[model samples]
Target chain A: MRRTRPPSPTSAGPATREGRRTWGTRTAAPTAGIATFEAGGWRLEAVGYSLRPAAHTEPPMKTRAVLSAIGPDRPGLVAKITDFLLARGGNVEDSRMAVLGGDFAVILLFSVDSAGFETIMRDRERLAAETDLALVLRRTEARAPQDEARLLWQVKAVALDHPGIVHRLSEALAQRGINIVEFESHVAPAPVSGTPVFSMEAAISVPASVRAADLRAALARIGDEECVDIDVRPDA
Target chain B: MRRTRPPSPTSAGPATREGRRTWGTRTAAPTAGIATFEAGGWRLEAVGYSLRPAAHTEPPMKTRAVLSAIGPDRPGLVAKITDFLLARGGNVEDSRMAVLGGDFAVILLFSVDSAGFETIMRDRERLAAETDLALVLRRTEARAPQDEARLLWQVKAVALDHPGIVHRLSEALAQRGINIVEFESHVAPAPVSGTPVFSMEAAISVPASVRAADLRAALARIGDEECVDIDVRPDA
Candidate 1:
């Protein structure tokens, strides 16, 4: 991706404009050097391919695995699973576990030598007989050590709470090949109006060729169509 | 991910074991499937890559980006940045923003049309001039649509507070090729004794070839030496 933005020095338009049938109906900020561009099917690909299991790809290190289980939360659940791992020689490295609404959920990472790796595979059946754990195992690779240059940004929206606001915007973005990394939503009462207010935040990655202006215009289009106010910022 | 832990026909051993030498010393359970294996430099690589920025490769979406900034907490920080994005036609989507201590931090995702993208690139400078934002931008790619078959697991360790607990454990797992996806640590005073206690949890991915038995042995070594109790569970 070019570090510098393409130059288009259009005289800044008035800080305000009207809503229209297009992405940016209102031109609150005048175009300084560049004119508003339309969002479309145009895109560019850098083509860097990396698979997961990345964490353990380095030869000398053994492999890593993720374990998660949700079942009746009880005292023995933790002990039972830990026992199985210890019995099978699985090393506990990291994890997040908790009990919610009477059900315990466990998420953790661990490793074993190649030999134990095979043994543990067979232990699955043994585990079933010994305990009642809904278990899922995933193999993950460690990421390679090369860093690629990329652009990051933050986006947010707020309006009267409504259904599908997230879906509408996200689906629209996804239709244009956008990636949503992190997202959150909340509804709170407006202090004066006492009306419910809905807000959302998301972290996304922009590819090299896509222009931020084009993305902004697209969001504006959605904002206008959906009756929500949208905002974007260069996350520093 | 499997929905349940594998079944093991092996009979249960005594609930208690002795390990004065270090973690799990007593052979409470007999070796059934295999004997204790050594942890070493055995590794394998299966490359399956999915790149971000899959948008251009697929349809009409522009690239997404992640933006983050943390500074003195105050009003208008959000307004200033969002205004910049709107001015440049940047679109807002998903984000995670919050206030902590006396600092306000915001991270969000957004997109732009190709033309708007360029305009916002220039707006970065305008953003800097118009506001006091310690910002960082990143280009991100959309993940390919493919279901990766994997083995996921969980790992945990707890004991009296110590400086190198996380380091020693992580380094050891790294050598074994374990990839830790998530990690959390905390120090709390024991209820009765008021002694400081350290605990950690992590999610990890294990390669298909790695053995859980071998991994456990490695953890046993660390736990013994580091004086920490550790546990592992199959995550469903």
Candidate 2:
């Protein structure tokens, strides 16, 4: 039998108030049949059973929060947001942040226990007032994990600058029941002439029944209709 | 029959003493079977055909060159490099540049025809001397279109501050023939007491036949051995 040690008391609590509620409970003992090891400088453990109870089998958390902060771009955007989460007892598990058009835009996904979640939501006005910024919060459900064995395709489009290119292309994919797993867009000056150019790349999951050729044809048609060049290639 | 446009007239000119070349051509009438569109201010065209042998596939042209300059960090790095490339009829295509540890590093991929390519290389010594920086130049080969799809996976490892965490984890992935697409790492100060912590996020490609679970397990084992925490998630 493998011996499991309790979580280190020194471990910092979750940064979000909700996270504190969800993960704050003490375990009676490390569950049996699990393994634990220490390698790089962290405590490593694997729970053989699901972390959440089967009866509760609540869906995975998928909520999107849009964070907008306008001020002099400084070195502490990350530090400030992190400090906020820590103060609220929340942990930011996933996030994308960047400076765009002179403003810092942050989109983050996080989870918290139901306890105190409402209170934090109500304090949005306070956060904005104190930080001199605006914040919008929305609840999002977690997406179902795609089958690991399914074939995936990459679609890329480039054209003279235009807006809503992503929206139109994504709508086409949605009509085909293709699930977009990832997407990114940028406007860059052309290498040779300095002409403004826009490019978008997307990774889409394709079910077994979908034919690559057919998908390509569909994209080609859409490209023609939209006057944008599109290419569909097999994603490794 | 499709009217194939002859190769660019300027592109095929004789190489100079310095081994530079130039090519200039105009687009031909659009093929009836092909599709073309404008997106994000750039024109994109797609033509489909079965692979076929050409009586003469032009020998790879050394039209492009990569110029790198390294020195103390400062502004004007972009301006200097751009001036050089533009003066010699070259154009910047794609680049990843950053300043690390107070040292400025610039890597640029750019293109030019043979005529002007030699002039650029011949002036390489003068460039280094004038800029007060080390300079390296390499003739570039024609780029084959990339048809393979790329998937990005974000992997993070947090362990006790150590020297070889990256090396150990990267070596395991290399042993499995995995290719790392991009990576960023930082040493974060622990929240409560400011204990040093090491964390790395790498974008990697997963080849067919390599299960995500298997990779996760391998990383878990490494984490256990090193006493670190590891998480592998899709970059969506």
Candidate 3:
């Protein structure tokens, strides 16, 4: 049997509130199979079946996959998906979901034991048909650790809606061997003028050989050519 | 056969470059199926086989679906996906993709004629098996227009790592009937201390009945209780 440790008593840190009386308090005494904490009048109470201590042996190697699903937006979509995963001993490690247009679109990273993973994979087609969802799944392995020496930059651009803006910018970055980490874009009406404006935000990693000034200049040149306002800054 | 108009000559807008000569010139003459424009020393050139005229009959309604796929990171993943879609008379309307860890994960919004859509949907299983991708698909319909009166706000928070942070904040918003439009969260090391810190950015819609001041106060209270720095501002 694996023994579990009690929750740590250390305060996360001081609250930002001014003139507030500070007290590190645990309102609910932690019993076995339970843990709780409190600070600055707020409480975090959790109940767990087991919490492993350090130096635990490695358990079964689980399979990881990315799942994307879309269906009519409704209240029970998330609960239904999670329930299915939970029943199969799978856990969602990361996920994002939104109601896009009239549909709920979700993407999740999940892990499960071999048996559970196989079951999910084999049943996917039936799952899609039964759930009335369009589903996409991709098996994944551990990601390579990010290169620390690469400088990360946040790029933002706003311009009148037009074609090839993203292509032009991405081409420029690719020429410099910059790696794009995250990207998002949308079209919204401009304030006052109400003209449709395209806005994009991207996180890109610059190789050490590239000078920040040169990169900025290159982006400025593209902005000038495309009549877009582009801002480049170090990501926080 | 369909006829395409030459690309439009309208200038997107003026460039931000200072003291540059302003000339709206057509450097490349418009050919039968080509259109081009130049302003502030930048040019946009496009060639098309067919551009729909304003007074055209309704074409076949296209089926739209959201596709999510992940595969081992490589040079041709996107090209392969796009090629597959194009061969089926499909178009990718919007997409976001990133190399996460060692895997390339992508989500695309695409549309195809009914026959092509059916073909793609039927071939999904084979596609996954042959391509070695985890895939998720969701068919979608036109989304209802957004409510213009809903006040949009951007919320950002940063704090020490802890469970229940997101749950607590989301619960507060949910109680007030606020709808989250978009949300993203990530964990990164603090600059000086190297402590793992959690950061979140979200866009939410507030019902007109909810006062902005009250919302801010509620968020502040949660931040105070949780020892997190929260910022609420109107989204542009």
Candidate 4:
């Protein structure tokens, strides 16, 4: 999440008020179902859970599936979903789940062998009915070993909010044989004038055959034609 | 797509032969069905699509739902999905549909009145079977009116990749009555030594009653305790 600043100090959130310290100082008490570390009695709370230690097992096949769901934001949603996946021998490798507005939206990628993945597929309807989760799963091939040749670069562009910025820019990169790894764009009002500004940042791959200069030149052309400012820098 | 540089330049890709410029110089040809503007023959390709002009109608309550599916990437996947939604009087508001790996992944939010939404819910099972697309429909509340008192800020933190980073930090924010509006985190290699680094960026809302300094202090403590580096910035 990236943002500029508010105009006034009050707009940044009311000045620190010493009198209104609302949080309870429940000293030395561990919240239910939560573990706390009492290091040196500093009242420092760990406030979290840790995974149980795992026993030795053969490294499993690296099959993957992309899973996504959206449901009313309610307690136990994550547990309900993760529990089902665990019970089915699917292990979540990575996930990006958030409450977009009031709805609980999630997109997860889990590892599961072919048979186990098919089992999840067959039960998709049942899972939806039972968990009250609107779910979709895509079986994916095992992750490939890392490619050691692609150079990475970061690019940022800003301009008046307009349609086609993403499509045009992405198309331009594609034409240059550059692959966009991560890209995010947002529009926010300009601080003083309140004009909406569209800004984008992308992590891209530059093939060794494609000079960074060539990619930068192409982006510059797109920027000139589209009336946006763009910058590309090597990833740190 | 976020990759380190490949080992061999030849293996990276075909050498940049100065000649293979593929995007057409089709001076002003409308690209098939997509709308195009032929202004002064500058070939300024009007870079996008616009909604079809609409006839006057009563302002409808914008009921929304998220629909997602994954199937072997094939032709007409979007058309098939959108046709179904359009047939049901639903208008696609926003969507993130892409071909990830070999499968087509789509997540869409569409608008319809409550009754029309219910019709789609009841038809969810049928939709899945008919289109061979695992479809899920979730009803979401209309967007809440903006709260002027909610101050926005961004927080970024990085540490060694560990299991509880997200849970612990999120719990801390929730305890302070903060709302995380947007968050994305990833575990990537540290450039120099290649140690895995867990980095998070969150856009949060602090009520007018909460002081930004206090919030920052608490986050700083979390960072110290968790061995992370954190930065928070306000958004205007």
Candidate 5:
């Protein structure tokens, strides 16, 4: 669920007290040829009637990137990558790594100044060759604010190991214009029988127009056809 | 969200077709004096009615542990810790790490055989001493399956930077017997005013009896009192 918060004291009280909550729509004449207005949802008034040259400093405009690396498991693999990033002034913001089979796979979100990012782009090939990693890098931005009408939901499914489960399920959501935000899956043995069981979990965003009951019924139908146990509910 | 799935073909079909879904409830006499029953939600039958010595192989009864380490940032830190774990037959299951200020902080989930776990416990002190790290380790287990009626929800809040935001918010939740599963927060400059805005997001599990409307109203009151914008939604 996405909804704008009701006005809070720190943000809205002062303007409301002035009997005008609108920005840049004032009908009254400016007291000093300077109009009071809001920018980026923050109230701003020309500090002091006399304006001086603004501070020369600019806010840090950091650029972010997503990096995925998969390589043979070996000592110093993580060190190599992290060391390189540190040397380039890149800061890791978030990361997840795991060992699967005999290989190590990692995904990292990092930010760097623009020039440092350029350097990373130039040197990525050399580092990949040295580390023997299959590397994928893509520039990314912070997620935009969510639309207030979108609904978030979670879905979980379990079944005997089978193929096309993700494809079939995702296709239905895609047809309905739903977006999958995060998904994870694993295969494990049934505690007693040692038979492989597949399980999946995903977070999705449903448009405001979709009916939850209709979506649940659709998923129940798919559960019957695919022999899967599917559960869908609003995501916390 | 945690409801046990309705009967599916592969797991439930066989038993249902036999006209008895209840395990070990048959009244008829067994032809071979063997009682068939479900174990761990699986169907199993004695093979060939033979009682020969069963295979001696044991399923891997792996144990899990959580490790948290923080140390001065330097080259090869990850390598040093991971190399030690690999040498001890430990497998990295999940990991998250980042550099906060000038210190590298990491939390890892790993699994090992019981003996190997004991070995790690014994050597952890030496590792911490040698690496100049603050290390904490605790045994963990896979989360038990969720109860069917528990409600999973997500909460997010943004407010002018202030003390006690988390404390006050969580206190309300704790009073309601809600459990926090995951939480993260950060402070960043407001886009225009450069005011430090504190933002938080959390995933929580509410008891079955908690009404969603009541929870929302409670959060709304907190938002008003704390001068924060709070959004609560059923999580997907």
Candidate 6:
């Protein structure tokens, strides 16, 4: 539920009375001339005190790219990868790199405007050839404004540790015309017994026709059939 | 904005039909002997059959703990930390450990039961005291539950990357009586210019009285005062 309103500048009462200002009025006055008005309460002595809105400047468009690299873990791996992007007209946006099972994997989201990206992607093929690393590149489109109506259901499943659990559940959701916006899965040892346990967290969008209760029931059924425990709840 | 609905299972055609079958409903009725039925197009004959509703049993409650560690970057850190959990009556649920700017930082969500948690929490202090590591314990009650609201608003600030951005924004939300369910923030390289950028993703609950527009306006003001760019949108 509803929690009590905390102390804030916008909240009513004494808090609002202390040097408070309206949103528009905060920026309306020139930053340099604010001291004069502060001396006298709301008295304007100057005539040309007109406020001009700041110029609207849109950020430059940049190319979006996805890159993946796999190789033996080594020192300066990230530095070398970043240097590659810097050599081109590219900038790394988001990246998740890890060394799992003795193999290094790197997934990067980057953007660039320089035309040299094509050449870099072609040249980096040699890294894979020489160092036993694999690299792939794909241009990505700008992410559209995400529609909120679809991101409603949050699903979690727990079961005995096993492979292909993620694939099965994801395939089931896809079959039901659901889209997963975010997902995380892991296998952890049981706290007391030391048995391995698998758990997954997924944020999904369900069609209006698919009632939440029905989806939960169906997931529960699937969990039972697969010997797991599933919890589906709305994700704000 | 309502979109067109995809086709349903029944609407797809007869191939998607689902039919229920009962035991002993088919074949020559046991002439005072055994009964038989066909399930999944397979012949099933039995002297007796029982039907039961599928139910999933909850796993035994496990004691959960959270650990924090910070140290100089080194190899085998994960193995050592995980081996510690394994040795104790604990399991690592989820963890985000990284080496940023030559310093390794780890935040792990883990669990242990009534078996040997006390000893682990006690012994873990030695690790923190002896090394640059820092460990903390968080029980299950300290963990926030997944919010059940469907709409999520993600607020991000980007300008010159600086500290205290998260603290200020979180304090603002806390002051406004908003509940933050989940949050993540990082300093990212700029997408186009290679400049430093600060980004934050917060899943928050907006009460009915507090419109999204108002929240955005408030955040925009904060961004202006702090010389940062703020983007507030639903977390689809």
lDDT tens digits, residue span A1-236, model 5: 01122223343322444353443322333577554443333333432323122246343467777666665544345556766776776755555454433444555556677887889989999889987876766566555555648888999998875544555676677667676554445556789888767677777778887899988988898899989999999987
- Please give the C-alpha DockQ score of model 1: 0.03
Candidate topping DockQ = 3
Measured against the true structure, the TM-scores of the candidates, in listed sequence, are 0.34, 0.39, 0.58, 0.51, 0.42, 0.40
Q: Which ten residues in a row have the lowest lDDT in candidate 3 chain B?
A: B1-10
Which parts of model 4 are misplaced by more than 4 Å? A1-65, A71-133, A138-148, A211-214, B1-142, B146-149, B171-177, B191-194, B207-236
Model 5 chain A lowest lDDT segment of ten: A1-10
lDDT of 2 by residue, B147-223 (tens): 45545678887876644455567667766666555444555568997866767676676655567788889999989
Model 3 C-alpha RMSD to native: 11.7
Ranking under lDDT, best-scoring first? Answer: 3, 5, 4, 6, 1, 2
Each candidate's DockQ: 0.03, 0.02, 0.18, 0.09, 0.03, 0.03
On residues A1-236, what C-alpha lDDT tens digit does candidate 6 reach at each position? 01122222332212133344321213234555442121111222123432222345323346666665554443345545655666675655554444332334455556666375676677777656654655656665544444544546888888886433454565566656676544445665788987778887766767666666767777777787778788888887
Per-residue lDDT of model 5, residues B46-92, tens digit only: 33322221245343467767676655544345556666676676655
CA error at residue B130 for candidate 1, angstroms = 6.4
How many steric overlaps does candidate 4 have? 8
List lDDT for all candidates, in order: 0.53, 0.52, 0.66, 0.60, 0.62, 0.53
> Compared with the true structure, what per-residue lDDT tens digits does model 4 show for residues B54-161?
234233455767776766544345545666666676755444454444555655556676777888888778767766776667777755755647778888888876
List of clashing residue pairs for candidate 6: A236-B149, B63-B112, B64-B111
Q: Write the per-residue lDDT of candidate 3 for residues A162-192, one digit (tens) a residue.
A: 5456667776787777877776666667789
Model 1: runs farther than 4 Å from truth? A1-236, B1-59, B74-120, B125-131, B142-149, B186-199
